[model samples]
Target: MTDDREAIVPVWTLATGDVRVPALAGDRPMTAERLTELRGVLAALADEPIATLEVHPLSDKLDRGRGIPLDAGSPLAQHLSQLITQSAKSSSVAAKATATGENLYRMVVPAKTAAQLGQGIVRPMAAKGVANGIRGAFVNSKGTIVDAASFVPVGKAAAAGAAGGAGATAGVAVAGSAALTVAAPLVLMAVAVGVSAHADHQRQQAITRITELLEQLHDQKLDDERSELDGCRDAIDKATAILLDQGKLGVSLGLDSAVHAIGKALAAADRRLTKWENALDELPEGKAVEIDTLTKSFPGVDDDGGTFRTHLELAGLAIALKRRVIVLQAVDHAQSDPGNPFENFARALKADQQRLDELESSIAGVLERLSALELTRTNSFRPVLTTGEVDRLMRAASRIRKLGDGVMVNSRATDVAIDIARNKDGSVVVFPSQPA
Candidate 1:
């Protein structure tokens, strides 16, 4: 018997970790090398023959503490919640990682698989050609796999009679949207009926492979940002503990120093946010002027690409710092509220999460404009543009684009999940729990 509780399918947790807040790479530039590493990982997943890929906001037991969710659409929810589209020619699944940018999810390329089956199935033109001919016939408009032949009756000559009948069958196979919608679920359920054991085995293999791929990924910048965010979380927790212990007597008990500590942390975060805002504000918007004019414009990159790299790096750092600052701001707001610290803090997570979204939107808008410059052509015919300058600009634009795409914050904070309870003296105790 198959263990229903057994996770036979692989679940790749792509997250920035801790505090359950929306954040990108903090204090690090997402360089071209970093972006290439990210794409390489996705390309590996894209090669997998995914049975069914579902993207959702990853939530850990800690995130849903005492039935209260910390996510409240803060981290990965904003992007993963968007539509995941499947590529007909390839097994690549693309998702809107940000409101304005698209990122690859996971899936398989049918064409690639068919090429591998060349000699095994038949001659060069037989198997490969057949697969190519029916490249997208199996997927519905929503990218769900469906049985194309299901639209017609089985074992009936009249259903596929010559000329008109065959033509109708092929048409339904290719563009029968209404019929596919009604039949897709039935096909999936039927396919899932008795393959539990096989599915479990495939899942185990996938998990192992994905784990290996993740281990191979090494981004020092992302690691540094994770540490910084952790420090910020620790700072918030420190203030929270003080408030819980002292209650209204915090000032009289000589613990008022904790308020100063909180202020310091908040100030540091604010400074980072201001720096990023000023730098980003300096970037020119693409829609503001003609593409030709934008290309001719110089936003401060030197011939060696040094200045452009600095700007891209700062933008990345800002993307990360901005997110952490949002959390700090929320905590500051909650701390000022004249209510239970625990309740107020939890409410602030959801209430103030919108700031993170706004930050992402602003970054995305700037990156979109930069992208136009990268794509603009500058040949000898257009003496106004140079190849070397455009190359440097392209590198900067690409890095900023990746930074603005936002990091996929995986749900792995259960270990840090804290629980709050009332003591006999009406005081509150926040303890960690290892949720099952």
Candidate 2:
């Protein structure tokens, strides 16, 4: 017989080397080439069938870069705690919430913030002051008086201004229009123009791919949001009955929190759903873009009359279908027996947790590797973060930690099964579980 523990999700360590968080790219600030590379990487994942994964919550946060845990709490708990602590420290107090009540302990922040108001404001401001001190050391980046003698050289500024006039053009266009340009005769000047033109084509290609992917994701989000709305309505409906029921003893103290949570969760879901609907609604008329120019400008290219676009649409549709079907398929694959939502949700959650951990490691790796040698680099020294950002981050971490501790995890399902299994066939099977 298979052991109960055997089916439990495996919690792999998140040491520095254990999980690699691929560098973020795409419509972000990373260069078009860099962004395209990243898109290819992430797109590969999005394109493929998601692995049969399980996300077992770690019982503790990994210490430093080691896979060793901070405590018995899950990595999700640590991630949540970090998120909470960081948010608590942010200047905009309202900005730190998980928006939706993803965790039951989200409510504790108002009380905690009020309790620790003094350090909440002071530490962050101090951190900002230190950061500004360092940033002010730079001679190039805009801010108050430049004190950073270590910033860019004077002559390079002119060169950069000239280069920016040249390079920034394509970056801006790709960031928005994803325009495809053409180069001059084969030379340095030609190379610059050709490079920009090439990037523009790739940018359009990526945008088309991503926008299409996002649309599919948006549909899934829409369904999920609708599900969220339904859940909220159900919770509120139950709470409404409880509120009206004078005979329901000991319900007020408990039910009030539940109702409040349901209301808050519902409102957040509404806000996000509205945002998604709005974004989806605003999709630009992509048909206006001229892929024919790229086909003609390059010697080996062929138009094929929107065939690539057709293929993109078809791929997007297929991906959407896969996502719709996969949750069911993954569940079927994971379950030792068929048709269990709790097991499905649990296993899916476990895999998500692993993925989230991987993302954290990836981000942290980038942070810890910044160097003074970075000073000599011709690349613009955009601060990876803004001032007071650390305090906000720290507070978020703390809050996530608190949230982890607040909620209890258990199997009401197992309890029910145990109850049913104990009763004899002919005997009165007294319901051992509460008749909610």
Candidate 3:
């Protein structure tokens, strides 16, 4: 016996779908209201069972609200409706309602049946002006388009139809010359629009990447600046601690005072030296006659009486003795002179000037060391002072302290007196005595 068997096929299958309307063109996005209108139009034409109806908004997810299901007469429609209504009432819907690219409407039917519905029902509705602003396509389980259609704008359709009819007639009349001119601009405009869109998309992506990179660089630079500031603070703290520990906190101030004192001393010594120099210059010219008379004078008086020869000899002898006595007196005055004011002033000036030079040199050395530390801080984000650098700075502090001590000793010495005694063997002893 021969038996006839029928093959069974799955009712529900996966399909790729897209539905774009006129509102999605240009800068306009698919808003909620517009999506509802499109859904209503699709619902009126959907006579068969639809498995799912997914609506993707053209706008970003943040702007698009909760999803709304199509009010189609299907088994899943009531459950989807309830879910959407609940989601709309509550603000905390975790699931994203919309996506970016395309909206989908699927039917749980055989591929043949879906294709028939698209051509018969959907295309008829488009022809009747119900799907006027719609453009869509449906793919089968194999990811191939089962059916697709686009509702052309009335103006574009009319222009296309007119151009086609004219080109057909002109092809025979002008030997295609008139047709080429008319069609060339339209083709070129379409190509230009496509190229411009592509270029604009690429430019936006490049700008986004560049902006991200710039932001990263800026953040890194700020971090480096902060690190540099931290290093500077640390360096300053270390330097301060070093100074405090060495008991040289006021070294700079002491040095400054010493400089001022030395400057004053130098000025006073300069004045005294000038005065003594003037006195020395005047002494030679003003005392010349006195010196000459003293040279010719004698110590003894004349003893001869009345006779010319005897009186002359006695006068010569008296003059010779007086001259000798004058010479001896002058020698005694020079040998016992207390001090040469000119020499003392010159020596004091030289000593004070030397001290001034030493103080200035110390100041310069300190400044140079500080400058080097500053440059290191300036050039690097995080600078660590070397052992040599720390040692140098410590040495500077020591020198400054020594300078202060020397100044203090000199200042005290100026207010005191020293007595010097010579021994029999030419050795000398100095005893410092307080001023009365």
Candidate 4:
């Protein structure tokens, strides 16, 4: 292992499923110093405003009092479906529907979950085994990959090399010129479309899986699943909103990556349909199903199903990825002030700021839509929270349930409950009945 201080590098480790910081690409074990440098990079990313938009596509439309029919297939209809989902998911709602058919603002989330949501910090790290790599979790509005590194455009290098360097003067240019000629522009464009669709589809998969995972998590022990579920939920909230606000008919469907991989593949098909839409005259065979999906307003396609909303989330992730890539690349242009570390830090800080700004804008929209739904919490847990140091025993009870309504999950009054009994002298106490 070479010392990481020697201009440390990152490599993807297939065996450990992580990004390994190394002295060089092929080097064995990474030096402690390189690991430290990589940690800084991970820390920088962790500090980003982690916002994910989750679209709640309606399986059916909410009928207006004066309505003849409310269409679920329409774009605006889908937006409303998501707003209802947010409020419903909050721990505030009972299993029963709104008996009054009334709608108002509600803060839906388990009390503890909501409390945990005080926008806690996130820290990114590499998993072990593979080369240097981060989890491909962050996605854009278009459902495309959003990593710090994407393949750089090859055109620039090709052009730069042809103009100058080595033996351009010796007509090394002629052979290169013929090679470029042989590669058809249309063929390359077609290939790009296929690659774009595939990337979009994979992103969809991640979104669906994660969403389905969240639903299942609610059935599990709270202690076992709260933290991970919270993270996934936040991602969905942010990703869904992005797609609802800004998505096109075909090329960009905002779908989540966790619960819907197949949705992405279909989206890939949609992309192919879009690419050939302009030039169907030249190539018009073997696309009957894809063409039908676009026609008749995508009838019988179950667009409002989990399979459908998943695509919307992926599209949103794709767009977000593009924005992130642009912002990250922009940082490279900043002239670093070596004497002032802040200069380099400033570039990174600015990128983070831009991301947060985007998140704030998205949140404002989501809150606006949700504000109309009445998901208010009628009751909640109250604990004596003091500014001064509190005993560890007290800390356990200090946790407040999120989205606390009238009901309590494992109340002190109920059997098989746990509590941190505390004494007046600020010591531990045990009670036969737990405190509510």
Candidate 5:
């Protein structure tokens, strides 16, 4: 048969001797490294993954009447609560501890198996509790004492005397004293329980406050994102309008007509040059020839002899003339090549078109994000955007506006005029000048 006893887990053991008072108020700030170390130690004892950890210093001292006072807001009380949480996470045991009215810490770790009931928990506690500065005993759920420790000698004697006098009254009657000393320890125990209850209430209140603050921050972030999305949409629309107007102006200026005329001229010149080259290729080859019977019939011809050697030379002058014509045609085509009227404008337009496309894509993405955020808001879920993403969107919008303004200025066209204005709310407004 399995034992139905609860297992004891060690929560925290205070350092032996005098308890050190924590320096809560000091110039030294808490560093991340120290916090990490503390978190590691607590997590090890808890034996469970820690979701969150927080620490707060006690602003006031505990009441000293009930031994070591374990008030709700005291640092010692908070530490006790931490210990209980740690132990509960590690073992099936449920426990609570608090500071006594005498300013001493006390905890109860339940006894488990037969061997653990006394040897595992009780004996070790009895031997180590006093050295650890703990003034109370480990008790089971049945109110059975597993082990006890006392720092004060007087308290120990009173407790022993109380046990001896259990049958008579409630505590040992002191000789020559009307009041029983054993009553003091019993009052201390009662106050510790009350303090533990109060501490629990305070912890709950703190948790609720923290939750509310986080919710407020989340809502604010959503509001900021919505505002940014509106701004981005406005920028995209303005930029698109500017580019369209510039494109129209370019067409009206006959810039497109000029480019078309030049293209036609170049094509015609190329065809004429090709025709001349073919004609030059078809010309007959030239050769040198000698006529021996020469000109015997020519009476006026100089004749050292009737068969005197006579040479005739023929060169391809027609082919050379055709080649010269082709060269002239090529030069004429080059000189008449009307360059693009709005070279800079064309380049800017291409770049702006690409940027415009990107802006549209970004707008779509942001809209999807906004829709998701809206759904989360409707469902009362937390929605957040990173600071970097927000900044990137803002920068993109700014660049689009600047690029649009540059295109208008560089176009130098009298048809389009950009105007900047400010509303009463100190927000900037951009618009095109109305034609009179």
Candidate 6:
């Protein structure tokens, strides 16, 4: 069974009976409201048994949040890379979702056999396949196939022609189009600052700028849009106030609170944007946009480019503003965490920044794809992607690219290796290791 729709709640299933669900943020105990929400999300995916629901974490970088072709090069991305490589099956996508993008991995497995795959029980599960199921697990998000050298089923000749010189050398023997590789291991120099009145002022000023930007971009058209921006402003204000009031003694706790609040706001806005895009997708005019594909040809679909471009424009403004605020909140903070707090902070900062980068890249990819479609068309009789749409997309991509490049601040030069250990129950446990 193939499903190609985006859902607010991300759900994935292993061929095994086990279904993966979203873990509550941090160690927060589940509340009735939270439980209710979880139940609703689960109910939405009940039609397919053995599913996994995970929300892609939000980040300060732009390219992070949007789902796209998978990166096969990064060590961190290896798990996903391996999953696709082993499975020969496509469909690992991070779906469009509210607050943050959600990923729904589709696996072809029987409902009965208790396959322990995708549970992270075994490091890089591909080494050991399920007792009875496909060799590799399948993953798809929002109708975009994960394109990796190892994932493509076709041989080299076909893949080479399809990729059209877009392929990156992954050193793996597999057929595919251009491969997206992760940037060099991000070296995040952790920083620890003693909370000072001056730092507090800087925070306030930063928050004010974010609030002003929110005000400037405030969309009065939809209550949902307005409310999202308003909520973001309030969250920053209240969370910042709490963080400052906590004094140096409680700076760690305060920063945590602030990050959480800001992240929530950003996520809420993202969700709203996703909903808006979904509505746009339903419109009769615009053509459907697909970022992941093997061939250079744009797929033919009845999708509205005007509405879609507008959605990207709005999202670009809103997400960029909030991310700037997050970057401000993250850098040069005093944290009381154990074991080289600076490195820890740097690691966290890098992760968030990378997320933003991924998001921006995805946006750029969308615009680029659309722009290419407009340029490469069959007939000159009234193009499907109008000139105005192409121009807007190009401008948006340029602006978004600049924002993504400049988002990171105070990053250190050395890369740090992260030691990730899984508990007996298959929950991942991450801690700092020495620098790589």
Number of the top lDDT candidate: 6
lDDT of each residue in 330-431, candidate 6, tens digit only = 432423342232233434444555554445444444443333332222233664778865664555444323323222222222211222222222222222
Steric clashes per prediction = 6, 40, 5, 98, 12, 41
Per-residue CA lDDT of candidate 2, range 219-242, in tens? 554344333322333333343233
Native RMSD of candidate 6 (Å): 22.9
lDDT (CA) for every model shown? 0.27, 0.23, 0.24, 0.25, 0.24, 0.30
Candidate 6, position 104, lDDT: 25
Per-residue lDDT over 358-391 for candidate 1, one digit per residue giving the tens place of the 0 to 100 score: 4434434454444334334423466666776577
- Name the 10 consecutive residues with the lowest summed lDDT in model 2: 414-423
Q: What lDDT does model 6 reach?
A: 0.30
Candidate 2 residues lying further than 4 Å off, grouped into runs, are: 1-305, 336-436
Better of 3 and 6 by TM-score: 6
TM-score of the candidate numbered 6?
Answer: 0.28
For residues 1-436, write the lDDT of model 3, one tens digit per residue. Answer: 2221211111111111111122211212233244334333432333321121222122212111111111222112222232233323331210233111122322122223222211111111001222111223333223434322221100110111112211110001122111111121111111111212222222233233333433444445433422322223222223223321222223343333333332343344344334433433343342222221211221111111112112122222222222222222222222232232112222332332343333333333332322222111112244786786566445434432332221111121111111222222222221211121
Residue 174, candidate 4: C-alpha displacement in angstroms:
60
Each prediction's TM-score against the native? 0.27, 0.16, 0.15, 0.19, 0.16, 0.28
Give the Å shift of residue 414 in candidate 5. Answer: 85
RMSD of each: 23.6, 30.6, 50.8, 29.1, 43.4, 22.9
lDDT, residue 360, candidate 3: 30
Instruction: Tell me the tens digit of each residue's lDDT in model 4 across 1-436.
Output: 2222222111111110011222221223344344334333432232211111111111112222111111343222332233233224431221122222222111111122111211111110111231211111322223333333221101101121111111111111122111111111111111112112222333344455436643643434322322322233333434433322222222233224322432343355346334433333333344322222222332212222232223333334433333222222222222122222212323443444343234323423332322222221122264553443233222322211111212222222111111111112222111111111
